[model samples]
Target: MAVLHPRVAPRRSTTRATTWWGKAWVRAVEEAAFSESDLVTARTLARGGHVGQITTRPGGFFASVEDQHGLWTVDGAIPELDETGTETVVEAVAAEAGRIAALLGGDLPHDLVEHTDEAGVELLPFGSELAATCTCEAWAEPCVHALAVLQQLAWLIEADPMVLLQLRGLAREDLLGRLHARRESPVSDDERDLDAAVEAALYAARLLDDPLS
Candidate 1:
């Protein structure tokens, strides 16, 4: 579980989503909203400091928010990556050795997400993948309060893309550890055989040249 301290409200000066991943997160949640007004109100609440401290667990985020209807508890849920999905994502990251370094440097490479998508694993929440419920008495599953939490979370994602991975159930340390282990693991028998064959061929060529010399 990761806890994020409250951010100073945007106060309508700057955009809420400062990064591409953060924008993608906002788009996902906004697409799930039942009404545009809900999104607008939620954005206002989030930017106005209506959302409180946020706690992010494996599958979701929890926070307190207030609006005209008063204070309410909001829980936002994003599906956790299954074991296969997690492995797929790790493989995608490992495909590009620098991806882990980029992530450690506070950058989320878009191609990494694209690679995961091609492998049928979504690193970002989409449509039904994002769900929420607010304590407020609203018919919508994700009421304004819930949307507010989602909005605030986008800001957090902008600051640290690791939050998105954590939401998908893998912490930064765990992901790095996995990548490091994968890199350090011994080569497969097939790879070893290929290497041996190439070495043998090179040695034969060198021997032939030595005789010519």
Candidate 2:
């Protein structure tokens, strides 16, 4: 579990996502409209630094937020990738060594999320794919508190792309482990060895006297 506090609490006028991926998350929230008023309240709560500790789980995440009534707890869910989907994730990660290296270094490339399509997986939420529940008595499908949590979660993913995949049901450690395994697979090793031998042969051939010439 990790915790994120708003570096600068949001303001009513702060109406944009800091990262492109973060913008996508904000768009998803906008798609599920209840009342614009509720949205305003949510963003206000976010910018005011009223949100609390956020904890991650297998298929979702949770956090608390303070509203006029009291402190409210919220639960967020993201659809998990299945076994076949997991295979796609592994294949994509294996295809790009730099992706894993960046993740290992705690940086996620801005384009990393785009590779999910090649893997036939969806790391980011689609339309109403992100769902939220709150203990607060706001009857909107996604109450104000829920939106606050989503906003914070988006910021979390911007800092670490691993969090996005984790919501898709792939743990960071497990995903990295699988990527490493594929990178070290026998096929890749054989290819590397063959390339090395070819390069060596060429280098040696070049050194020979120009008898053929």
Alpha-carbon lDDT of model 1: 0.78
- After superposition on all CA atoms, how large is the RMSD of candidate 2? 11.6
Can you write out model 2's per-residue Cα lDDT over 1-213, one digit (the tens) per residue? Answer: 343434446555675677677787788877765778878887788778788877876688888898778998898888889999887876665555465656644565655656766656776677588788899777886888988777777777777767777787787667755644443434665445433433443444456646464
Query: By lDDT, who's the top model here?
Result: 1
> In order, what lDDT does every prediction score?
0.78, 0.70
Model 1: how far residue 117 lies from native, Å: 0.7
TM-score per model over all chains: 0.82, 0.77
For model 1, name the residue pairs that clash. none
Worst 10 residues of 2 by lDDT: 193-202
The per-residue C-alpha lDDT of model 1 at residue 125 equals 84
Tell me how far the alpha carbon of residue 166 in candidate 2 is from the true structure, in angstroms, after superposition: 0.9
